[model samples]
Target chain A: MPKKKSEESKSNNKGAVRPDGRKVDELRPVKMEVGVIERANGSAYVEFGKTKVVAAVYGPEPMHPRHLADPEKAVLICRYNMLPFSVEDRKKPGPDRRSIEISKVIKDALSTIVALEEFPKCMISVDMVVLQADAGTRVAALTAASLALADAGIPMREMMSAVACGRANGKIVVDLTKEEEDAEDAVDVPVAMSSLTKKIALLQMDGDMTLEEFEEILNKAEEACSKIYDMQREALLNKYEKEGKEVNINDE
Target chain B: MMSSKLTAEYVRSLIERGKRLDGRKLDEFREIKINYGVSEKAEGSAEVMIGNTRVVAGVKMDIGEPYPDMPNKGVLVTSAEFLAMAAPEFEPGLPGENAIELARVVDRGVRESGAIDLEKLCLVEGEKVWVVFLDIFVLNHDGNLIDAAGIAAIAALLNAKLPKITEDYEIVRDELTDPLPIKDIPIPITIRKYGEHLLLDTTALEEDVLTGKFTVTTKINGNICAMQLSDGMSMTKDEVLQAARMARDAATKIREKLFKDKLKELKKA
Candidate 1:
């Protein structure tokens, strides 16, 4: 017997099971590769389902534009670029207002762990390119860029990991895809944290939700980010292993 | 930072002893890392890190009028930017001579090697064709930017996909048709000669004291695609031939280790 359209819609919304069959609290599959760019001091490639991002780190070298050079510390710069065909619509090349805002936030988040003062009169640059984006690219870029910086052999107090959670349908969901992102009344909450200290480095929220729901989403994001932190560490360790270097994972 | 005479002399002395300050053999390259599909928005993108030097290359495709001379073939434009934040020496704004030279070297390698099958990119005979824009950025410069940039550019092209074109002539940005046809992989190897010693992948400090440098682009089939020589000093025919042989050997190793498996995986997708 054919089911009614209304009945089908209701059943689909009941458990908030996504089109890809992920539950409200589930995350998309993630893949990480470290030291992927041979020309950068450090580089990483990350994939969160269909969302893909690449990050490269270069520096502790002398800062350009002499005036911007801090005598007491190294300056950190982060740039994020999305290609024209990354989305359903073709985007123009170059930095747009949205990219500029995201770049600033990512820079601020990374500055927390970067021991900039250790290398005076120098700078560190982190460049991220989103080759394909389904959703949650900012978080993916942050996570990948941090790993790239680590791969560059930069001194850091701790590493940072990021993940996004949002309200889709009527329930909280982790790692929303583009379809879920476009749903009515959808809210996105992206959170980044210092892996060792467990302190929030970046927190941005959009849409509307109750305070309790927000707290639950944050908890879910934290849990997901923790898992990502391990993956980031593993990627870094694997690169060294491939180079025949012994890495003590517990040294941190 | 200016190169010090003391540092140059020290490097020369170390080279004479068959050693580098970083504790590497004269012909040994530093660690290489290549990652593709870094940019979600571009048709293709790659990031390459050779030791401390970092470069990112992104390929974008668009429909445009074909050139009168080559109406049937597609167009490939290459440009390079040396970000000011990458190094103290690099200035922002317009590309300097060094940046222009880097782009030309990479472009020559790809174009001459016929790495991309441009004929397949044509839409209309003389009216419309696909234009591939390959943009490279040097995010960090520890030296050997030419080799790194070339690798990134080629990898980005290998990773590229064509946007679906409807029968009605509408270009669909979201749906990808298939991977662009890649004919060959041309790998560039830059060698710096410091006094009598020839060094591979020179660091910035080493480059400052280099007597001369030459980059040879070799294809997977052990053929020379393009060659560039710069600086005041010159190399003899024998030296150039030796460099070519070395570059070919290195290209083969890189093709096998870094690209073979990845290319297979990309093809499967």
Candidate 2:
């Protein structure tokens, strides 16, 4: 669909039914798979409705260039790339300004969960590719990457779950699709939290809302993230279950 | 960035015997996979994989003034980026020599082949013209990034379309008009010389021991459009000619196998 028409639809549908016919605070269906790529130390694939992402983890290996190595903790590098066909328009294949910024935030979000001090002078790399994109791809990528890190056997405090909430057509929505995201006056707030501790690890906002609206969005996102966290844990369990080994998240 | 001496010596011994460590013949290529329209934000894009090596190319078209030297024709700007996550050896920063060389080689092949009719892109002669930007990105660096990037660039260009243009010289980005003017397919073939053996499509391990490398870009008519020789070890004239012939054959095979199906699909779309 053209950008103009999508924008127009956003305005015309104010206070009306959503395109997907879900409640204002409902999330799109999510699916996750672990150990998807053999080349990387660990990998995962995730789908949040129409958005699809693949994440790969490498290292706890030695850092390159020598100088970038930290003396006390491992350095984390995250990269997010959207494939050319991932969206309505073909995206250029590299790290543009948006991707670079997204990479930094993802790295920071995952850093809180990873026990980087356990591997001194080492590096942990996370690579996420958006095979298809609708909206909230950055959050989806981060969610998959966190799972990949755990699958790689990297020690961490807890797994992270990320979700985005926003105001669409004057109503708060838990997860916005591409069309809703393009709507004018839409306010997006993406939040990530530790599943075990419920501690916020990442928060970002665009557009505007009242403090009460922001808090309401946060509460809704937290609720959605709890469900997402269970899904992530189940994906890990499924992989280990297939290997015929009984695994426990708490034991690890 | 350097391979162990023991591994290098082992590779050389195998090459001397007309065998590679991967159990393939000296002239054998690794498996290749190509997918078109991998990005939706650009005019055209493709992702290509040669063995473990992966590269993506995206083409974006915009209106701009023509270059002083080519005022009557459109312009093609090519650039390459090596993602730090692709390989441990690749660091995050500006483009280095390898990145620059890769972009130039791919650019030269496409430009010299007359693949795109630049004259058709001109909005107004010497005033405004359509500038085509080909951005190549290395997503994985197992080896042989040149050939993979070249293939991606060609595939992306083949899939490109021009946005609708208005009479007042405004470009309606959301409405695409027609496919870009593409004339020929240019394929690049790179051969690595390692210890008296010319190996085609060397893996990362083999690349460390290679003393010389030669790349030949061939067009559909069996004409050489661009040729580059990275000097490390010297090559005889006959050796160069033999490598060129091998490259032409490889290009032809690749065009038939990898490009034909995609071309047909694009035409139907």
Model 1 score (lDDT): 0.81
Q: By DockQ thresholds, what CAPRI class is model 2?
A: incorrect
Q: Number of backbone collisions per candidate, in order?
A: 24, 14
Candidate 2, residues A158-250, lDDT tens digits: the string is: 898888888888788987988887676676767777788676655555554544565577678888888889888988988888665444544
Q: Model 2 — TM-score against the truth?
A: 0.51
TM-score of chain B of each: 0.94, 0.94
Chain A TM-score of each candidate structure, as shown? 0.90, 0.89
Provide the lDDT at B249 for model 2: 91
Question: Candidate 1, which segments miss by more than 4 Å at Cα?
Answer: A1-252, B262-269
After best superposition, candidate 2 residue B177: deviation in angstroms? 1.8
Candidate 1 residue lDDT tens string, B48-119: 999989999999999998888789989999999999989998778988656766787788789767788889
Q: Give the range of the ten consecutive residues with the poorest summed lDDT in model 2 chain A.
A: A1-10
Q: Is the docking of candidate 1 incorrect, acceptable, medium or high quality?
A: incorrect
